[model samples]
Target: MFSASRGFVPLLAAAALTGVLLGACQPQGAEAPPAATAGGPVRILSAKGLNPQAGEASPQGRLLIGRGKDYTPLNEDPKALFDKLEGSMAERRKTGWAIVEALLEPQKLTLDGKTYDVPLWHTWYEGMSANPEVDQKIKLFIAQLAACKADADCHKSRAEIAHEVMAQSGTDKNLVRSLVSANLTQVLKQSEGFDRGNPEDELGQGFTLFSPSFVEHVLAQAQGIETCSNKIPWNQAPPSAGQFSPCVEEFPRSAVMVKTNWDQIDGASPKVSAHATDAAAVTAVLKGGTWPKPTLEPVDPSGIYTVQTTDGKLFGLKSIHISTKDTREWIWITLWWSPKPDEDFGQDRPASLARFNGGVWSHYKMCVTTAFNETDPKPWGSYETAQPALAAAIKASYDGAVEQRNPAPYDKVTTWCSNPNLEHHTGNGRTNCIGCHQYSLTWNELKERPAYFSDTYAASMAAEYPQYGRARRRANFPAEFAWSFGMEFQEQIKTAREDQGFSW
Candidate 1:
């Protein structure tokens, strides 16, 4: 069974969604965005209207406005960054759906001298290592600091200032020693295991992508500590009397993060099922310690999106979790490939999606929750709406939470969400997206940073375990609900200890 830590993307086996094209996905017969020169500025044509920087509302009353590139000020005033997600449940779903379509547009990447047109979301800069240029700059700084490690005479130098900052913060002594004992390569690769899927499932490979704004905020904070600590300026508790920390930072409202799961199809090819592989198959794939590059051909009749890497390996997208900081609480959405997509989760998918990329998106079923629980006034899907599938899915999610309680005193509530490919094992399947991620926090000890507590996946755990529920979450929003950041912090600790020849 899978543990609470891991989560994944897929095309839908369901029927196509129907609705008006909201300028997120392409309109009828619209072509994918033209490929840009590799290493050049992204043209971003298809995402123009969806740009939250425009600060406008759509015809459906959805707030399209969101914080964008100029979001640095948002760090000082976190609440101002939140734009309430206004509109009915169906309208809100359209907003989320539009966001998904906008991200799915083709983005070209040059890997190993070959151009691959992957989804825009796939092109986000990998966070494990800073870009080469940035890495070089950091290395130079680290080298300078290492040179002045024990020299009392170098106190007035820039390197000394950096060392002093970290030393005063308490966590830096271990970090500096760890960097000195190990080569730079080890430190950069330390956080790479974040997307290793569940160690329990060998065929699974997951990737988490961060929006440029999100990365920028992280870098800005890192720069504050001389690029040594990945710490965000957060407090131990929520703000008092509606006042937020002037220095407390968070991912901007425009910050959109995605986690995608990939399947290793090797010889399975056309016979591959539109579902998760069994554990036996996973064990077979990981018989050795090495993770083989996935290889597989498309299922002949189904038009699911598959990727062939420069290494001659083939991989298929299995599931996707998209989250945005549009609202203060953020919007949670998950999409998975379903063999029977049009049923259950796919029943109310919009029809207009057929126009985008030749209906490639129609093969994916999606569900989204803007609030923690079902706050909709109507009887779930009782009202006539353009996106009944979204409404019903959300309702079903809350209902599932209610059922999980089994009796009375179900005071705590949340909408359930899980990806079949990503959150498949044990406690994961019954998890709520936000409910699990809300625990993305770390200890506030300024001296020695500790390891991260595991995340939760069981639905209604909040009601059963109030100590770690929303109240605890509200009091401790350490990583601002971005587990990757917290993981990065902890991985550094691991790298430090390992480099010092200490093994757990």
Candidate 2:
């Protein structure tokens, strides 16, 4: 069974965001103006996203060069610099920004005899189940499981089972490795897992997309390990189960995952606070079922990246959580739509973003983290240097929470990067992207449901949170710092086992 406490804090307690529905007769061409922003005039860059006909690998290569001489040019070999995963926090921040720029760059796609320009990442990724190869892989694994169960003394290793399956089945390894990914489905719970439909009170829809490289790495590991079983060698160390392949200089795109939170926009209102639910309200919010019923009708498209699903539904991007295996611990970055785009996390956003595609994306704010502990050196990337107000805001928020309970110490040294929309559960203001993710482990290792606040603070000056803190004081193997392995893969295998009529 999957771990009961998936390490998520909880959803925001705020009331659901509401919208004023427009008249049903409005023409599609009569698009409303983009939401007003402190960054200046809104630009309508392109009408592109999610082409149903285009496959995962359809749109490849960079679209635009990043601005400024220091930034790596995306049009060139951007991954070359990204692979560096430099030691210093400042350099890692720059690399993180460069990667985000590449992801946001528009790519061209044609649908129904018309051209649409969408962000490269949107065109390049799909839901994990969307890949046809995964089902085949699951079947092969199930066969291996049944064979082992039937034999009295079956001592075959995962490698042996994989070899046998490949030889007999002639499995196409490359096809499995080339697929894109998906399945986060809530307002702000993108990282939690796939298709967790919104519970009442949660506002928007969330999607977590994986690049081909990320899928390839996970598939390679699944092919080599028995993820569904609780009998994996528990004593094995770092390179064993749960640990993902590293992002090295040789393989730059080892693993790249993005989680985006979106709200349905009503073109008549175009308010950030508004949602498309008002037009075609959900008849009921399923507790543990599929997305709410009574499909939300499409509102007229406004400014910002908006997509019209094949079902004629519409969604507007609000926030994004991006974690790339750029560094050993990975670079944690988040961007969210804000009326005051130039303040806090959005401070120091390059002018190139404003100029690119007529500044359509200038309304989003960004923050990145490379190190577990925040040590601010002047003239570099720090909440203080890059965004002092953000640092103060985080501290203030933490202080308010601390009055109610004994929360972790809030100070300048606490590295912070919390998406307000996504990370609202518990003391989310005090939580960094690396904190909860560090607890990502296999089902066997996490069966105990270790203390969430055990290793929140640094153990000492020498070690970071993952190695030295109380939470990870015990020897454990991580599922590559990715919660999806347990939440998605194990769940999929569980379903597959049921399909094979195999009881746990």
Candidate 3:
């Protein structure tokens, strides 16, 4: 009976195994798996009240893992937000004149008794409209804070109060000043790393704090300075009084007009000769009236020519012009009598005239061409191409002159015209074509401030050349060629004077 029971057991086990395999291969009716919740906690449908999903250890139940009902979203504290806004306002103020003007509107505040109108103010305000909810919240906060009766009340909710203040017109003087100062400080800090240390380098800081024009205007107002004239209070002065001379013998009272064709002038550049031939040519090129043949005005060889103007002040004649091609372009003509011999008086006169006409007048034409070409639709085909070509032509002419001379060994030359302190050591290193003639400040100054070239070349060049469109926008020219010769000349003079035991 026991053996029979064992056989039956084996048969039953085999049959169960076969049934299990068949069941595994057969398809059973099954429910589809649940889909994933987008950016939300996963949930299992099979859990209940002890709510394992709510517990950190539960994986098979609904979990509120992020900012859902069980989790609260973090809020930026009012104080921190207000502080950030204040910082932003200040940064915008330093960037440009426009922002400063907007910040200093009449209703808001004034600096140095002047109010600037910044167009950017409206644009900034309008930008806030893009976020109506935040804008409304800011507006409400501001209204409540402004309505507060005391500082104690304002401090009750400091962050709310600050938000209100920033959203409003910013009329409080102390607040406005603090904001401005803070913005400037931030700009100064960020600007430390800039190699150039110019205003453009801090543009981002400026825009964040204030608009461009407003920043410039406010800074100017703060400094109590004017950008146009650059004249300070201490610099204003009247013309000097004329010196009187007693009548003397030996010196003739007669004056003779010196005239030479621009082409005949020894120092005149070929570029100059191409445009102007004589005084008339110069006047025509400059759009000034033709200069008449000069007749010397008589003077008491010793007594300078004095004119009693209608204003009743007797002033010595500095110079007078007989005529000009265009009266509009005529600046002024002044003649100075030579205190020394007449021969010594005219030593540099011809060269000076040619320099003035070629360097100044031709430069003006180049500038006009540049401006027109920049604005023209067909600029490349127009005068635009002419500028670089002309510059090249001028450069070639200068090179021709230097090449014609006998080559001086670099070691034989005591000093380079550009850097007199640095001596050339090798005979092989001859000064190139550009090195000799590229130090022309007259031409550089014209490029810097075309409008002011005729009236104030030196001053304009000093102010604008370092930050001019070309210098600021394009790659910097090589220092060897771009620096003014005046500096080199001054250095040479200083060295010579020191060698002679004289103070510069």
Candidate 4:
């Protein structure tokens, strides 16, 4: 899986997705976008669009998300990101997160009479300890395995794997401590496990052994940060040019997912949530003060707003050329949350999640990609529209002559959850999540870059999207944006280092 044989791809069998190209990007063939029944699901394309390039999976696809038959494909740069994100969210909601589970190869560890499905990090000790005594025992274990393989009637015992190690240590106590505690030592902390399959490990799964203190820090930061939320229209689209028309900041709290004493589910109340996570407390902790003690309200359930495509067609599929295997529409349900109960956002929160394509992007319709109900009537800001002035300010600030926060870097951070799973494989496509800009820690990183808040940068971003000359995403976004895993790592590292009185 590490090498490029299987496209350098890992095991992804559990998804509705057949296979990913990851070669040259999936290219869109010459064809009009497919059409959904006026009120039906959109039609999906076949998976024949794979083009294997030298070192990249160049998937060129356009998911039709607009009016029936007259689909707007999300094939271009900037707008593509938006539409793709929405598409991915929708897919996840459709599949109830089987797509997410596909990303993980959970370890089946047998310890004591009970088995624990430990995080990947704990698997490190299952191999050789690099000690001769241990290696000899490992040899014996291998021999036993071979003998059993030769005997069709024989079954391998789970404890047999642990025997060699436990025998040397005399008890399971030392082994358990070493596996959990010693593994955290600085040297081992930097092992291959830390970086391997990062995309999967960072899916907000709450599997990592996060420090108690770090979790608190997360809640604190989230509490102080203001919130910006938008509810999907129950009957119509928001008026924004991006297709999210007539959107507003506030919706009934029912629009937010309800948590139970037992678990957290991802829908408005009535239809038992398709996606459920027992880690509601953790999610609330991560959400910080915004949730306000964040307990799930009584089952006095809020209702759900189902997204039904006109003509039973998947606008996403019609707009793009992709695998017919991919599902067209999900049994989609939406929930939005924000800290501002009073419904006022005055630059207090990073709205990394919402954008209306109201800025320079507003002028281009075909290039603007978005879910029909996710955006607002006008998401653009004055700063994003100021070209010459913004461009000039950016040049001056980047050159180091001026320290300007004048435009004052401000972007909203929106979160999304979905099922069915978007075919984009960066992460488990089906799940709750923050916006991509914040997902990668890019928003935080961009703040550190020069003149990032200037209008020029916004224009540059718009240019990379469809309305402008949509170009491939610039490298800077990943190099800097830190979300999910990045956020955790940063906070954990700082906390650990400070506690050590300046140890790296």
Per residue, candidate 3 scores C-alpha lDDT tens digits across 1-504 of 111111111110111111211112311222212222333332111111212212223322121111101111113342343333223311111121121222222221122232111111212211111111223333343344345533453444534454344445432111111112122123221122434333322111211222222222222121111111211111222122211111101111111111001101112221111111222322231122112222223222113322121111222222211101011111011122322212211221322221210111111111011000011212112212423432332233223223323222211111111000010111101222122212222223335431221222122342432211111111111111211112222233234334434321
lDDT of 4: 0.22
Instruction: Give all candidates' CA lDDT scores.
Output: 0.42, 0.43, 0.20, 0.22
Candidate that scores best on lDDT: 2
Q: What is the lDDT of residue 121 in candidate 3?
A: 22
Q: How much is 497 displaced in model 1, in angstroms?
A: 15
For residues 39-127, what per-residue lDDT tens digits would candidate 4 score against the true structure? 33322322222222211222332211111111122233534444453444222222322221221223332212222122121121221
What TM-score does model 2 achieve against the real structure?
A: 0.56
Question: What does candidate 1's lDDT look like per residue over 116-224, in tens digits?
Answer: 2334554443344322212222333344444555567665554344334323322101111111111112322212444445564433344455665565455434432
TM-score of 3: 0.14
Q: Which whole-number lDDT from 0 to 100 does residue 475 have in model 1?
A: 41
| Residue 381 local lDDT, model 4 | 25
Ranked by lDDT from best down, the candidates are 2, 1, 4, 3
Candidate with better TM-score, 2 vs 3 = 2
Prediction RMSDs, each to the true structure: 15.3, 13.9, 37.1, 24.8
